[model samples]
Target: MSKLDALPHGPEFRFVDELVSLEPGKQALGRYLVKGDEAFLVGHFPGNPLMPGVILIEAIAQLGGVVAQSDPEIAALKNLLLTGVRGAKILGAAVPGELLEIEATVEGRLGGMIQVSGRVSTAGRELATAKIMLSGEE
Candidate 1:
């Protein structure tokens, strides 16, 4: 059980709404829903409410960010950046009213680069999964 953060997203790009739980690299989960006022979704379909693939990737990255920021292994690093998304898949689509449960567990860390693999689910159904990466400040 975790609560959402009220961080101001740059532009209209708020990817996540909550910080469910984070345990360094071991595990992390977060949640979010589409904001009606979001420009991207406003005309994404005009009538359909699909959480886009890019947003899903962002949600995963956000979780990865939290892990990097909290993990003592990389906490002292001034900056942490989510460096990649697989970029070749749409595991599934998340609907507007669905509560997404995104979970991540650290898979490996090489030097300052950390990798976390995770999945996104809506009501117990997996929507998407990916291996996200982060790099600490040099």
Candidate 2:
């Protein structure tokens, strides 16, 4: 199993496939492969399947969480929850078999919460972008 697979999220819900690179409390880059046979693809569309925007946001958040958790202080807490999202926009649709590249940058931290902004893209095409807040738990 990959490092991302070891996160708190289960297999069915884990959106992060690989941690390509990371800089604690600064930034992170990751990728996820959209397997055509994924459960979400079965009913997302009948004749045509498309990755849902929510999933894209989740992927972004998961990537951001990995970045935040890279900090020794946050990792020691052992839990991270997405608390808020803002300025989210989907610019394109992601299809199965494509590799989704996710990137996140830390904006600041508020007590136990880490704020970040992220973007998702495939093959150099923008798919989505959002600002998210994650709270760490002890």
Return the top candidate by lDDT: 2
TM-score of each candidate structure, all chains considered together: 0.80, 0.91
Kindly list the per-residue Cα lDDT of model 1 for residues 14-68, writing each as its tens digit: 5767777777657777877655556776677788867787777777776766665
RMSD score of candidate 1 (Å): 3.2
lDDT of 1 at 100: 82
What is the TM-score (0 to 1) of candidate 2?
A: 0.91
- What TM-score does candidate 1 reach? 0.80
lDDT of 2 by residue, 1-138 (tens): 544654788889988888898887689899999998889888999779999998999998888887776675555345678889999998999998999999999899877888899999999999999999888765
lDDT of each: 0.68, 0.86
CA deviation > 4 Å runs, candidate 2: 1-6, 73-75
Worst 10 residues of 2 by lDDT: 69-78
